[model samples]
Target: MSAATARATIQAYYDAFNAGNAAGMLDRVTEDIEHRVNEGAIRHGRALFAEFCSHMGVSYREELRDMVIFVSEDGTRGAAEFVVHGEYLQTDPGLPEARGQRYVLPAGAFFDLKGDRISRVTTFYNLNDWIAQVST
Candidate 1:
């Protein structure tokens, strides 16, 4: 994969997310993709990823804005930074009670690419910031 292709793949993944198309996002990842959730455990395989997406879909409605993507010259690695504008739709376990609380968070993700698909995704965000925003 070229750098351009890596960037495009990352962009398409985000586009699918914004479109609420989980299948589209899934298409960009490998069958054994490793998903490192923000402040959570690492999940392996497409099936686990699908489950995570389903839970997130029920808990929050979110859009990533001002995204900037970067890819390595070798095209084996990539990263993206964005702002998440979201509304908490349901109460997630161990989180604050959700009453449609709105929050804006700065987040980023690092990716490991294999061929044309993403093999790993490790996401990062300020959990305290998110908690404070939803708590109020």
Candidate 2:
């Protein structure tokens, strides 16, 4: 894939997320996608990814804004930085209790592309900052 194509693929993934189309986002990934969550365990495959999306949907509502995407010359690696504007809709286990709290946080994700689909996704953010913001 060309660099432009890779950037488009990554951008489409975020667009899908912002549109609340989990399945559409998943469609852009490989079957054995490796997902490294922010301050959380690494998970593999599409099934687990789907479950994660479901859990997140129930616990929080989020959208990415101010996105900036980057792609390597080889088109095999990419990254994005964005701000997450979110609402804590319900309590997640082992986390602060939720009461529809709103928070904004800067976040980023690194991507490894195989052909056109994303094969690896590593996301990062300040978990403590999120806790502080929502805990108030």
Candidate 3:
């Protein structure tokens, strides 16, 4: 696939997430997905991804906007830029306060894709900003 195509596909995955549909996001990825947030938090397989989604239920209710895609030269990889808007699910990990305050966080990700499946994903976002959003 072209870099642009890969980027578009990745963006669509987030679109599905924004809709609060974990199954939808899974549809865009390979059965064996690699999701990594830096080094310590690396998740593999679709099942794990789904479990992770469960945790997100408290914090994310399909709120994402301003999706932008950035592609590599060869199309083997790409990145996305967007903003997440939601109520602060303070109890959730990597997020903010539980009292449900309005929050916004800038997010980005790098993807290693094969065919239509995303084989690997390295996500980036500001934890501090997330805290600000969740904290009342």
List, residue by residue over 73-136, the lDDT tens digit for candidate 2.
9999999999999999999999999999999999999999998999999999999999999989
For each of the candidates, the C-alpha root-mean-square deviation to the true structure, in angstroms, is 0.5, 0.6, 2.3
Q: Regarding TM-score, does 2 or 3 come out ahead?
A: 2
lDDT per residue as tens, model 3, 1-136: 8877787778778878877877888888887889888434789998888888777775555477898888887778888888877775546644343775776788878898888778888888887676655665
Give the number of colliding residue pairs in candidate 1.
0
* Candidate 1 all-Cα RMSD: 0.5
Cα lDDT tens digits for candidate 1, 1-136: 9999999999999999998889999999999999998889999999999999999889999999999999999899999999999999999999999999999999999999999899999999999999999999
- As for TM-score, the candidate ahead, 1 or 3, is 1
Poorest lDDT segment (10 consecutive residues) of candidate 3: 88-97
In model 3, which runs have C-alpha deviations exceeding 4 angstroms?
Answer: 38-40, 93-97
